[model samples]
Target: MSRLGVLRAVCVAVGLLPALAHAFLVNQWETIDTSTKRAQAAQDVQPGRAWIEPLTGMDMVWVEGRCFKLGSPPKMEGRDGDEGPVREVCLSGYWLARTEMTQGQWRRVMRNNPSKNRKGDDYPVEQVAWDDVEMYLGRLNSFYTGRVRFRLPTEAEWEFACRNGGQQVRYATGNSAEQGSWFQRNSGGVSQKVATQRANRLGLFDMSGNVWEWTQDAYDSHAYKQIEPQNPLRLGAHPFRVIRGGAFDSKPAALRCSNRGFEHFSLQAANIGLRLAAEVEKPVKPRPINLRDTLL
Candidate 1:
Protein backbone atom coordinates (compact mmCIF):
# COMPACT_ATOMS: atom_id res chain seq x y z
CA MET A 1 0.00 0.00 0.00
CA SER A 2 1.07 3.59 -0.54
CA ARG A 3 2.50 5.57 2.40
CA LEU A 4 -0.59 7.81 2.55
CA GLY A 5 -2.79 4.75 2.59
CA VAL A 6 -0.80 3.20 5.39
CA LEU A 7 -1.10 6.41 7.34
CA ARG A 8 -4.84 6.46 6.78
CA ALA A 9 -5.09 2.92 8.05
CA VAL A 10 -3.17 3.83 11.17
CA CYS A 11 -5.51 6.74 11.80
CA VAL A 12 -8.49 4.48 11.43
CA ALA A 13 -7.06 1.99 13.89
CA VAL A 14 -6.55 4.79 16.36
CA GLY A 15 -10.15 6.00 15.78
CA LEU A 16 -8.91 9.45 14.78
CA LEU A 17 -9.32 9.38 11.01
CA PRO A 18 -12.45 11.16 9.94
CA ALA A 19 -14.80 9.61 7.39
CA LEU A 20 -14.69 12.77 5.32
CA ALA A 21 -11.82 15.18 4.81
CA HIS A 22 -12.19 18.92 4.48
CA ALA A 23 -9.68 21.56 3.43
CA PHE A 24 -9.31 24.76 5.47
CA LEU A 25 -7.02 27.23 3.79
CA VAL A 26 -6.11 30.32 5.85
CA ASN A 27 -4.57 33.53 4.52
CA GLN A 28 -1.29 33.74 6.42
CA TRP A 29 -1.64 37.54 6.58
CA GLU A 30 -5.38 38.07 6.76
CA THR A 31 -5.40 40.56 9.60
CA ILE A 32 -2.41 42.76 8.76
CA ASP A 33 -3.31 46.43 8.40
CA THR A 34 -1.75 48.21 5.45
CA SER A 35 -2.24 51.78 6.66
CA THR A 36 0.78 51.99 8.97
CA LYS A 37 3.60 52.75 6.58
CA ARG A 38 6.35 52.70 9.21
CA ALA A 39 5.24 49.35 10.64
CA GLN A 40 4.76 48.04 7.12
CA ALA A 41 8.32 49.12 6.27
CA ALA A 42 9.65 47.26 9.28
CA GLN A 43 7.68 44.20 8.28
CA ASP A 44 9.23 44.40 4.83
CA VAL A 45 12.72 44.00 6.22
CA GLN A 46 14.01 40.41 6.20
CA PRO A 47 13.49 38.82 9.62
CA GLY A 48 16.69 36.78 9.21
CA ARG A 49 18.33 34.07 7.10
CA ALA A 50 16.87 31.16 9.03
CA TRP A 51 14.68 28.83 6.98
CA ILE A 52 12.38 25.95 7.86
CA GLU A 53 12.97 22.27 7.17
CA PRO A 54 10.93 19.14 7.70
CA LEU A 55 12.99 16.98 10.00
CA THR A 56 11.75 13.62 11.25
CA GLY A 57 8.54 14.30 9.28
CA MET A 58 7.96 17.46 11.35
CA ASP A 59 8.44 21.07 10.19
CA MET A 60 10.96 23.09 12.25
CA VAL A 61 12.53 26.55 12.22
CA TRP A 62 16.27 27.02 12.77
CA VAL A 63 16.77 29.27 15.84
CA GLU A 64 20.10 31.14 16.23
CA GLY A 65 20.02 31.18 20.00
CA ARG A 66 21.08 33.90 22.52
CA CYS A 67 20.02 35.24 25.95
CA PHE A 68 17.01 37.15 27.33
CA LYS A 69 14.86 37.86 30.40
CA LEU A 70 12.90 34.75 31.36
CA GLY A 71 9.90 36.16 33.20
CA SER A 72 7.63 39.23 33.36
CA PRO A 73 8.55 42.32 35.37
CA PRO A 74 6.56 43.40 38.44
CA LYS A 75 4.92 46.53 36.99
CA MET A 76 3.53 45.40 33.62
CA GLU A 77 -0.23 45.79 33.35
CA GLY A 78 -2.31 42.64 33.81
CA ARG A 79 0.73 40.84 35.14
CA ASP A 80 0.19 37.49 36.79
CA GLY A 81 1.85 36.87 40.11
CA ASP A 82 3.32 33.69 38.70
CA GLU A 83 4.89 35.53 35.74
CA GLY A 84 7.23 37.40 38.09
CA PRO A 85 9.68 38.14 39.53
CA VAL A 86 11.63 38.63 36.30
CA ARG A 87 14.85 36.72 35.65
CA GLU A 88 17.52 36.23 32.98
CA VAL A 89 18.01 33.19 30.78
CA CYS A 90 20.61 32.02 28.30
CA LEU A 91 20.07 29.47 25.51
CA SER A 92 22.28 27.51 23.16
CA GLY A 93 21.73 27.67 19.43
CA TYR A 94 18.86 25.53 18.18
CA TRP A 95 15.96 25.36 15.70
CA LEU A 96 12.22 25.72 16.30
CA ALA A 97 9.09 25.62 14.10
CA ARG A 98 7.56 28.74 12.61
CA THR A 99 4.11 27.70 13.76
CA GLU A 100 2.25 24.94 15.50
CA MET A 101 1.68 21.58 13.78
CA THR A 102 -1.14 21.62 11.26
CA GLN A 103 -3.66 18.94 10.42
CA GLY A 104 -1.89 18.18 7.15
CA GLN A 105 1.48 17.66 8.85
CA TRP A 106 0.03 15.58 11.67
CA ARG A 107 -1.87 13.38 9.21
CA ARG A 108 1.32 12.83 7.24
CA VAL A 109 2.94 11.37 10.33
CA MET A 110 0.32 10.00 12.78
CA ARG A 111 -2.46 9.63 10.22
CA ASN A 112 -5.02 10.67 12.81
CA ASN A 113 -7.59 13.35 13.62
CA PRO A 114 -7.45 14.05 17.31
CA SER A 115 -9.10 17.42 16.72
CA LYS A 116 -12.65 17.48 18.06
CA ASN A 117 -13.70 19.66 15.14
CA ARG A 118 -11.80 18.80 11.99
CA LYS A 119 -10.56 21.80 10.03
CA GLY A 120 -8.61 22.16 6.78
CA ASP A 121 -4.99 21.15 6.25
CA ASP A 122 -3.66 24.59 7.14
CA TYR A 123 -5.47 24.97 10.46
CA PRO A 124 -3.45 24.17 13.56
CA VAL A 125 -3.97 20.54 14.66
CA GLU A 126 -5.69 20.70 18.03
CA GLN A 127 -6.92 18.25 20.70
CA VAL A 128 -3.55 16.58 21.04
CA ALA A 129 -2.40 15.98 24.60
CA TRP A 130 1.19 16.77 25.59
CA ASP A 131 2.02 13.09 26.01
CA ASP A 132 0.69 12.44 22.52
CA VAL A 133 3.20 14.95 21.17
CA GLU A 134 5.96 13.04 22.95
CA MET A 135 4.80 9.83 21.25
CA TYR A 136 4.81 11.62 17.92
CA LEU A 137 8.36 12.83 18.54
CA GLY A 138 9.53 9.31 19.31
CA ARG A 139 8.30 8.11 15.93
CA LEU A 140 9.69 11.22 14.23
CA ASN A 141 13.13 10.65 15.78
CA SER A 142 13.11 7.14 14.37
CA PHE A 143 12.28 8.50 10.91
CA TYR A 144 15.23 10.90 10.64
CA THR A 145 18.99 10.38 10.62
CA GLY A 146 20.96 13.31 12.04
CA ARG A 147 22.97 14.63 14.99
CA VAL A 148 20.14 17.01 15.97
CA ARG A 149 17.24 15.53 17.93
CA PHE A 150 13.57 16.63 18.08
CA ARG A 151 11.83 17.98 21.21
CA LEU A 152 9.76 20.96 22.42
CA PRO A 153 11.17 24.43 23.15
CA THR A 154 11.52 25.53 26.75
CA GLU A 155 9.31 28.42 28.00
CA ALA A 156 12.24 30.82 27.79
CA GLU A 157 13.14 29.67 24.32
CA TRP A 158 9.55 30.06 23.23
CA GLU A 159 9.37 33.64 24.51
CA PHE A 160 12.80 34.60 23.20
CA ALA A 161 11.97 33.21 19.79
CA CYS A 162 8.53 34.77 19.86
CA ARG A 163 10.07 38.10 20.74
CA ASN A 164 12.49 37.52 17.85
CA GLY A 165 15.84 37.83 19.68
CA GLY A 166 16.29 41.42 21.02
CA GLN A 167 14.00 43.45 18.75
CA GLN A 168 11.22 43.04 21.27
CA VAL A 169 8.70 45.87 21.10
CA ARG A 170 5.69 43.78 22.13
CA TYR A 171 3.75 40.98 20.54
CA ALA A 172 6.28 39.50 17.95
CA THR A 173 5.67 42.43 15.56
CA GLY A 174 6.80 45.32 17.72
CA ASN A 175 4.15 47.35 19.60
CA SER A 176 1.16 47.00 17.30
CA ALA A 177 -1.31 44.23 16.53
CA GLU A 178 -2.17 45.90 13.23
CA GLN A 179 1.26 45.03 11.84
CA GLY A 180 0.58 41.28 11.45
CA SER A 181 -1.51 39.43 13.99
CA TRP A 182 -5.04 38.16 14.62
CA PHE A 183 -6.41 39.35 17.90
CA GLN A 184 -9.76 40.37 19.44
CA ARG A 185 -9.76 43.58 17.35
CA ASN A 186 -9.42 41.48 14.20
CA SER A 187 -9.13 37.72 13.26
CA GLY A 188 -12.64 37.84 11.72
CA GLY A 189 -13.78 35.30 14.32
CA VAL A 190 -11.54 32.45 13.07
CA SER A 191 -8.01 31.28 12.56
CA GLN A 192 -6.42 32.41 9.31
CA LYS A 193 -3.77 30.78 7.09
CA VAL A 194 -0.40 29.81 8.57
CA ALA A 195 2.24 32.01 6.95
CA THR A 196 0.08 34.93 5.79
CA GLN A 197 0.73 36.89 8.99
CA ARG A 198 3.87 38.97 9.46
CA ALA A 199 6.85 37.01 10.73
CA ASN A 200 8.91 38.05 13.76
CA ARG A 201 12.43 39.51 13.54
CA LEU A 202 13.70 35.94 13.39
CA GLY A 203 11.38 35.18 10.49
CA LEU A 204 9.08 33.04 12.59
CA PHE A 205 5.41 33.04 11.53
CA ASP A 206 2.32 32.84 13.74
CA MET A 207 4.17 33.14 17.04
CA SER A 208 1.63 35.40 18.71
CA GLY A 209 -1.93 34.70 17.61
CA ASN A 210 -2.53 31.43 15.86
CA VAL A 211 -2.53 28.72 18.50
CA TRP A 212 -0.97 28.17 21.90
CA GLU A 213 2.22 26.14 21.41
CA TRP A 214 3.44 23.44 23.79
CA THR A 215 6.81 24.00 25.45
CA GLN A 216 9.26 21.60 27.13
CA ASP A 217 9.22 23.26 30.57
CA ALA A 218 6.76 21.89 33.07
CA TYR A 219 4.50 24.45 34.82
CA ASP A 220 5.40 25.85 38.22
CA SER A 221 3.70 29.08 39.24
CA HIS A 222 6.82 30.35 40.96
CA ALA A 223 9.63 28.57 39.13
CA TYR A 224 10.85 31.67 37.30
CA LYS A 225 11.18 33.69 40.53
CA GLN A 226 13.86 31.45 42.05
CA ILE A 227 15.65 30.32 38.90
CA GLU A 228 18.95 31.87 37.82
CA PRO A 229 18.80 34.40 34.98
CA GLN A 230 21.37 32.68 32.78
CA ASN A 231 20.43 29.29 31.40
CA PRO A 232 16.77 29.39 32.46
CA LEU A 233 15.51 26.11 33.88
CA ARG A 234 13.78 23.65 31.55
CA LEU A 235 12.44 21.13 34.06
CA GLY A 236 10.45 18.77 31.86
CA ALA A 237 10.04 15.92 34.35
CA HIS A 238 7.66 18.04 36.43
CA PRO A 239 3.87 17.98 35.96
CA PHE A 240 1.78 20.51 33.92
CA ARG A 241 3.88 21.55 30.95
CA VAL A 242 3.81 25.14 29.60
CA ILE A 243 1.94 26.32 26.47
CA ARG A 244 2.68 29.61 24.71
CA GLY A 245 1.06 31.88 22.08
CA GLY A 246 -2.65 32.65 22.12
CA ALA A 247 -5.23 30.60 20.24
CA PHE A 248 -7.89 31.61 17.68
CA ASP A 249 -10.52 31.97 20.39
CA SER A 250 -8.38 33.98 22.77
CA LYS A 251 -8.70 37.69 23.48
CA PRO A 252 -5.98 40.29 22.88
CA ALA A 253 -4.80 40.09 26.49
CA ALA A 254 -4.13 36.38 26.25
CA LEU A 255 -2.22 36.87 22.99
CA ARG A 256 0.49 39.03 24.54
CA CYS A 257 4.05 37.73 24.18
CA SER A 258 4.52 37.27 27.93
CA ASN A 259 1.15 35.65 28.63
CA ARG A 260 1.39 32.11 30.03
CA GLY A 261 -0.80 29.10 30.75
CA PHE A 262 -0.65 25.35 31.39
CA GLU A 263 -2.54 22.09 30.94
CA HIS A 264 -1.93 18.46 31.82
CA PHE A 265 -0.10 16.33 29.25
CA SER A 266 -3.09 14.07 28.66
CA LEU A 267 -5.91 16.62 28.47
CA GLN A 268 -6.49 17.42 24.83
CA ALA A 269 -7.93 20.86 24.06
CA ALA A 270 -8.95 22.75 20.95
CA ASN A 271 -6.60 25.68 21.57
CA ILE A 272 -3.43 23.61 21.98
CA GLY A 273 -1.00 22.61 19.22
CA LEU A 274 2.79 22.34 18.98
CA ARG A 275 6.06 23.43 17.40
CA LEU A 276 9.16 21.20 17.07
CA ALA A 277 12.77 21.84 18.11
CA ALA A 278 16.11 20.26 17.18
CA GLU A 279 19.42 20.58 18.99
CA VAL A 280 22.41 22.14 17.23
CA GLU A 281 24.68 19.54 15.69
CA LYS A 282 28.18 19.00 17.04
CA PRO A 283 31.00 16.85 15.66
CA VAL A 284 30.64 13.35 16.96
CA LYS A 285 32.95 10.40 17.45
CA PRO A 286 31.33 6.99 17.64
CA ARG A 287 32.74 6.49 21.11
CA PRO A 288 33.45 10.06 22.22
CA ILE A 289 32.68 9.51 25.87
CA ASN A 290 33.03 6.09 27.42
CA LEU A 291 30.15 5.39 29.81
CA ARG A 292 32.41 3.60 32.31
CA ASP A 293 34.92 6.46 32.42
CA THR A 294 32.17 9.07 32.82
CA LEU A 295 30.62 7.18 35.73
CA LEU A 296 33.91 7.36 37.64
Candidate 2:
Protein backbone atom coordinates (compact mmCIF):
# COMPACT_ATOMS: atom_id res chain seq x y z
CA MET A 1 0.00 0.00 0.00
CA SER A 2 1.07 3.62 -0.54
CA ARG A 3 2.31 5.60 2.48
CA LEU A 4 -0.84 7.77 2.50
CA GLY A 5 -3.06 4.69 2.29
CA VAL A 6 -1.10 3.04 5.07
CA LEU A 7 -1.40 6.13 7.29
CA ARG A 8 -5.15 6.36 6.74
CA ALA A 9 -5.59 2.67 7.52
CA VAL A 10 -3.41 3.00 10.63
CA CYS A 11 -5.40 6.02 11.83
CA VAL A 12 -8.71 4.25 11.27
CA ALA A 13 -7.42 1.21 13.14
CA VAL A 14 -6.32 3.48 15.98
CA GLY A 15 -9.78 5.18 16.03
CA LEU A 16 -8.45 8.73 15.77
CA LEU A 17 -10.81 9.90 12.99
CA PRO A 18 -13.88 10.37 15.21
CA ALA A 19 -11.94 12.48 17.74
CA LEU A 20 -10.48 14.60 14.96
CA ALA A 21 -13.93 15.02 13.42
CA HIS A 22 -15.38 16.17 16.73
CA ALA A 23 -12.63 18.74 17.17
CA PHE A 24 -13.20 20.11 13.67
CA LEU A 25 -16.97 20.28 14.13
CA VAL A 26 -16.71 22.09 17.46
CA ASN A 27 -14.45 24.75 16.03
CA GLN A 28 -17.14 25.73 13.53
CA TRP A 29 -19.32 28.31 15.24
CA GLU A 30 -22.58 27.21 13.65
CA THR A 31 -22.14 23.53 14.33
CA ILE A 32 -21.38 23.99 18.02
CA ASP A 33 -23.64 26.95 18.73
CA THR A 34 -26.44 24.51 19.46
CA SER A 35 -24.23 22.60 21.84
CA THR A 36 -24.72 23.08 25.58
CA LYS A 37 -21.25 24.63 26.00
CA ARG A 38 -21.90 27.44 23.55
CA ALA A 39 -25.33 28.19 25.01
CA GLN A 40 -23.88 28.57 28.50
CA ALA A 41 -21.34 30.96 27.07
CA ALA A 42 -24.08 33.19 25.61
CA GLN A 43 -26.00 33.84 28.79
CA ASP A 44 -27.47 37.24 29.63
CA VAL A 45 -25.46 39.85 31.51
CA GLN A 46 -25.90 39.79 35.26
CA PRO A 47 -25.42 43.13 36.93
CA GLY A 48 -22.48 43.27 39.38
CA ARG A 49 -20.99 40.20 37.76
CA ALA A 50 -18.91 39.22 34.75
CA TRP A 51 -20.76 37.42 31.96
CA ILE A 52 -20.60 36.88 28.24
CA GLU A 53 -22.81 39.19 26.22
CA PRO A 54 -25.08 36.87 24.20
CA LEU A 55 -25.02 38.66 20.88
CA THR A 56 -21.26 38.85 20.52
CA GLY A 57 -20.10 36.55 23.31
CA MET A 58 -18.02 39.41 24.70
CA ASP A 59 -16.92 38.98 28.30
CA MET A 60 -18.14 42.03 30.18
CA VAL A 61 -17.07 43.08 33.65
CA TRP A 62 -18.86 45.41 36.02
CA VAL A 63 -17.13 48.63 37.07
CA GLU A 64 -18.58 50.18 40.20
CA GLY A 65 -18.67 53.93 39.70
CA ARG A 66 -16.99 56.40 42.00
CA CYS A 67 -15.61 59.93 42.10
CA PHE A 68 -11.92 60.30 41.43
CA LYS A 69 -9.32 62.61 39.93
CA LEU A 70 -9.37 62.85 36.14
CA GLY A 71 -5.85 63.75 35.04
CA SER A 72 -2.18 63.38 35.83
CA PRO A 73 -1.02 65.14 38.97
CA PRO A 74 1.39 68.04 38.47
CA LYS A 75 4.33 66.08 39.84
CA MET A 76 3.60 62.73 38.15
CA GLU A 77 6.51 61.49 36.01
CA GLY A 78 5.86 61.36 32.26
CA ARG A 79 3.18 64.02 32.67
CA ASP A 80 2.20 65.61 29.39
CA GLY A 81 1.15 69.09 28.36
CA ASP A 82 -2.48 68.01 28.01
CA GLU A 83 -2.74 65.75 31.06
CA GLY A 84 -2.68 68.37 33.72
CA PRO A 85 -4.90 70.64 35.77
CA VAL A 86 -6.40 67.60 37.36
CA ARG A 87 -10.12 67.63 37.89
CA GLU A 88 -12.48 65.53 39.98
CA VAL A 89 -14.59 62.99 38.06
CA CYS A 90 -17.62 61.07 39.26
CA LEU A 91 -19.12 58.26 37.19
CA SER A 92 -21.86 55.67 37.34
CA GLY A 93 -21.31 51.93 37.33
CA TYR A 94 -21.18 50.32 33.88
CA TRP A 95 -20.24 47.22 31.97
CA LEU A 96 -16.99 47.20 29.99
CA ALA A 97 -15.52 44.57 27.74
CA ARG A 98 -12.60 42.85 29.44
CA THR A 99 -10.34 43.16 26.40
CA GLU A 100 -10.26 45.21 23.25
CA MET A 101 -12.82 44.10 20.69
CA THR A 102 -11.40 41.22 18.72
CA GLN A 103 -11.39 40.82 14.93
CA GLY A 104 -13.64 37.81 15.34
CA GLN A 105 -16.24 39.88 17.20
CA TRP A 106 -15.99 42.68 14.61
CA ARG A 107 -16.51 40.28 11.72
CA ARG A 108 -19.43 38.68 13.50
CA VAL A 109 -21.21 42.02 13.72
CA MET A 110 -20.04 43.99 10.65
CA ARG A 111 -19.79 40.91 8.41
CA ASN A 112 -16.32 42.10 7.44
CA ASN A 113 -12.99 42.67 9.16
CA PRO A 114 -10.86 45.74 8.47
CA SER A 115 -7.77 44.94 10.50
CA LYS A 116 -4.40 45.42 8.86
CA ASN A 117 -2.81 42.67 10.89
CA ARG A 118 -5.22 39.87 9.90
CA LYS A 119 -3.17 37.72 12.22
CA GLY A 120 -6.04 35.89 13.93
CA ASP A 121 -9.64 36.20 14.98
CA ASP A 122 -8.56 36.93 18.57
CA TYR A 123 -6.36 39.86 17.57
CA PRO A 124 -7.87 43.34 18.04
CA VAL A 125 -9.44 44.80 14.92
CA GLU A 126 -7.59 47.85 13.57
CA GLN A 127 -7.61 50.09 10.50
CA VAL A 128 -11.12 51.19 11.39
CA ALA A 129 -12.10 54.84 11.66
CA TRP A 130 -14.20 56.34 14.42
CA ASP A 131 -17.16 56.73 12.05
CA ASP A 132 -16.91 53.08 11.16
CA VAL A 133 -17.12 52.20 14.86
CA GLU A 134 -20.25 54.31 15.22
CA MET A 135 -21.87 52.20 12.56
CA TYR A 136 -20.81 49.02 14.31
CA LEU A 137 -22.22 50.27 17.61
CA GLY A 138 -25.45 51.21 15.87
CA ARG A 139 -25.96 47.70 14.60
CA LEU A 140 -24.94 46.18 17.91
CA ASN A 141 -27.40 48.36 19.78
CA SER A 142 -30.22 47.40 17.47
CA PHE A 143 -29.91 43.84 18.75
CA TYR A 144 -31.18 44.99 22.15
CA THR A 145 -33.96 47.26 20.87
CA GLY A 146 -33.00 49.81 23.55
CA ARG A 147 -32.67 47.45 26.47
CA VAL A 148 -28.94 48.19 26.54
CA ARG A 149 -26.58 50.49 24.71
CA PHE A 150 -23.10 49.52 23.53
CA ARG A 151 -20.59 52.10 22.39
CA LEU A 152 -17.03 53.29 22.79
CA PRO A 153 -16.37 54.72 26.23
CA THR A 154 -15.89 58.45 26.63
CA GLU A 155 -12.45 59.84 27.50
CA ALA A 156 -13.30 60.15 31.15
CA GLU A 157 -14.94 56.77 31.26
CA TRP A 158 -11.97 55.09 29.63
CA GLU A 159 -9.56 56.75 32.01
CA PHE A 160 -11.71 55.88 34.99
CA ALA A 161 -11.62 52.20 34.15
CA CYS A 162 -7.96 52.23 33.20
CA ARG A 163 -7.08 53.66 36.56
CA ASN A 164 -8.70 50.64 38.19
CA GLY A 165 -12.12 52.15 38.64
CA GLY A 166 -10.61 55.47 39.71
CA GLN A 167 -8.27 54.33 42.46
CA GLN A 168 -5.21 56.29 41.18
CA VAL A 169 -3.05 53.84 39.23
CA ARG A 170 -0.47 55.25 36.82
CA TYR A 171 -0.80 52.62 34.11
CA ALA A 172 -3.68 50.51 32.93
CA THR A 173 -2.01 47.42 34.28
CA GLY A 174 -1.95 49.33 37.56
CA ASN A 175 1.78 49.88 37.39
CA SER A 176 4.46 51.93 35.64
CA ALA A 177 5.58 49.72 32.75
CA GLU A 178 5.12 46.76 30.36
CA GLN A 179 4.78 44.16 33.10
CA GLY A 180 1.38 43.15 31.78
CA SER A 181 1.24 44.17 28.12
CA TRP A 182 2.82 44.18 24.66
CA PHE A 183 4.58 47.46 23.90
CA GLN A 184 7.61 48.79 21.97
CA ARG A 185 10.04 47.10 24.31
CA ASN A 186 8.63 43.64 23.59
CA SER A 187 5.98 43.81 20.84
CA GLY A 188 8.33 42.93 17.96
CA GLY A 189 6.50 45.53 15.82
CA VAL A 190 3.08 43.86 15.60
CA SER A 191 -0.16 43.15 17.33
CA GLN A 192 -0.65 40.11 19.52
CA LYS A 193 -3.62 38.05 20.61
CA VAL A 194 -5.95 39.57 23.17
CA ALA A 195 -5.60 38.60 26.86
CA THR A 196 -2.07 37.35 26.15
CA GLN A 197 -0.87 39.28 29.18
CA ARG A 198 -1.82 39.45 32.83
CA ALA A 199 -5.00 41.31 33.64
CA ASN A 200 -4.93 44.42 35.78
CA ARG A 201 -6.48 44.64 39.23
CA LEU A 202 -9.79 45.41 37.56
CA GLY A 203 -9.49 42.14 35.62
CA LEU A 204 -8.79 44.08 32.39
CA PHE A 205 -6.11 43.27 29.86
CA ASP A 206 -3.81 45.53 27.85
CA MET A 207 -4.86 48.66 29.68
CA SER A 208 -1.30 49.95 29.56
CA GLY A 209 -0.33 48.96 26.03
CA ASN A 210 -1.61 47.14 23.00
CA VAL A 211 -3.29 49.15 20.30
CA TRP A 212 -4.50 52.70 20.92
CA GLU A 213 -8.19 52.53 21.80
CA TRP A 214 -10.66 54.98 20.27
CA THR A 215 -12.97 56.74 22.73
CA GLN A 216 -16.24 58.63 22.35
CA ASP A 217 -14.90 62.10 23.16
CA ALA A 218 -13.51 64.66 20.70
CA TYR A 219 -10.10 66.23 21.10
CA ASP A 220 -9.57 69.43 23.08
CA SER A 221 -6.27 70.25 24.71
CA HIS A 222 -8.05 72.41 27.24
CA ALA A 223 -10.97 70.14 27.97
CA TYR A 224 -9.72 69.52 31.48
CA LYS A 225 -10.13 73.23 32.25
CA GLN A 226 -13.88 72.81 31.95
CA ILE A 227 -14.12 69.22 33.12
CA GLU A 228 -17.35 68.12 34.70
CA PRO A 229 -17.42 66.11 37.90
CA GLN A 230 -19.70 63.41 36.57
CA ASN A 231 -19.69 61.48 33.31
CA PRO A 232 -17.67 64.04 31.38
CA LEU A 233 -17.89 63.78 27.60
CA ARG A 234 -16.28 66.30 25.22
CA LEU A 235 -17.71 66.57 21.76
CA GLY A 236 -18.11 68.73 18.65
CA ALA A 237 -15.33 71.28 18.71
CA HIS A 238 -12.64 69.61 16.64
CA PRO A 239 -12.26 66.91 13.99
CA PHE A 240 -9.92 64.92 16.21
CA ARG A 241 -11.32 62.37 18.63
CA VAL A 242 -9.81 61.06 21.87
CA ILE A 243 -7.87 57.79 21.90
CA ARG A 244 -6.33 56.11 24.94
CA GLY A 245 -3.87 53.36 25.75
CA GLY A 246 -0.64 53.35 23.82
CA ALA A 247 -0.02 51.29 20.71
CA PHE A 248 2.52 48.53 20.17
CA ASP A 249 5.12 51.08 19.12
CA SER A 250 4.34 53.50 21.95
CA LYS A 251 6.95 54.40 24.54
CA PRO A 252 6.40 53.95 28.26
CA ALA A 253 5.61 57.64 28.68
CA ALA A 254 2.76 57.44 26.22
CA LEU A 255 1.44 54.35 28.02
CA ARG A 256 0.80 56.17 31.29
CA CYS A 257 -2.79 55.89 32.42
CA SER A 258 -3.19 59.67 32.27
CA ASN A 259 -1.40 60.26 28.99
CA ARG A 260 -3.75 61.36 26.24
CA GLY A 261 -3.72 61.06 22.47
CA PHE A 262 -6.03 61.94 19.63
CA GLU A 263 -6.34 61.57 15.87
CA HIS A 264 -8.53 62.85 13.09
CA PHE A 265 -12.00 61.36 13.40
CA SER A 266 -11.56 59.98 9.90
CA LEU A 267 -8.16 58.50 10.52
CA GLN A 268 -7.80 54.71 10.63
CA ALA A 269 -4.49 53.06 11.32
CA ALA A 270 -3.07 49.68 12.24
CA ASN A 271 -2.33 50.91 15.75
CA ILE A 272 -5.89 52.00 16.50
CA GLY A 273 -8.68 49.71 17.74
CA LEU A 274 -11.45 49.86 20.33
CA ARG A 275 -13.28 48.31 23.27
CA LEU A 276 -16.94 48.64 24.27
CA ALA A 277 -18.93 49.93 27.23
CA ALA A 278 -22.53 49.90 28.33
CA GLU A 279 -24.30 51.89 31.00
CA VAL A 280 -26.04 49.24 33.09
CA GLU A 281 -28.76 49.56 35.66
CA LYS A 282 -27.71 48.95 39.21
CA PRO A 283 -28.44 45.43 40.33
CA VAL A 284 -31.12 45.24 42.97
CA LYS A 285 -30.26 43.51 46.18
CA PRO A 286 -32.31 40.52 47.23
CA ARG A 287 -34.05 40.65 50.56
CA PRO A 288 -33.15 38.16 53.18
CA ILE A 289 -35.62 35.46 54.14
CA ASN A 290 -36.90 35.55 57.72
CA LEU A 291 -38.68 32.69 59.49
CA ARG A 292 -40.19 35.21 61.97
CA ASP A 293 -42.28 36.68 59.11
CA THR A 294 -44.51 33.58 59.08
CA LEU A 295 -45.35 34.01 62.78
CA LEU A 296 -46.05 37.68 62.33
User: lDDT for each of the candidates?
Assistant: 0.70, 0.83
How many steric overlaps does candidate 2 have?
0
Report each candidate's C-alpha RMSD, comma-separated, in the order given: 10.7, 12.7
Deviating ranges (above 4 Å) for candidate 1: 1-59, 228-230, 281-296
Top model number, TM-score: 2
Error of 1 at 173 (Å): 1.1
Distance from true location, Cα of 217 in model 2, Å: 0.4
Candidate 2: where are CA atoms >4 Å away? 1-43, 281-296
lDDT of 2 by residue, 80-154 (tens): 879978999898888889999999999877767889999899999999999999999887765653345688898
Backbone clash count for every predicted candidate, in the order shown: 11, 0
Which 10 residues in a row give candidate 2 its minimum summed lDDT? 30-39
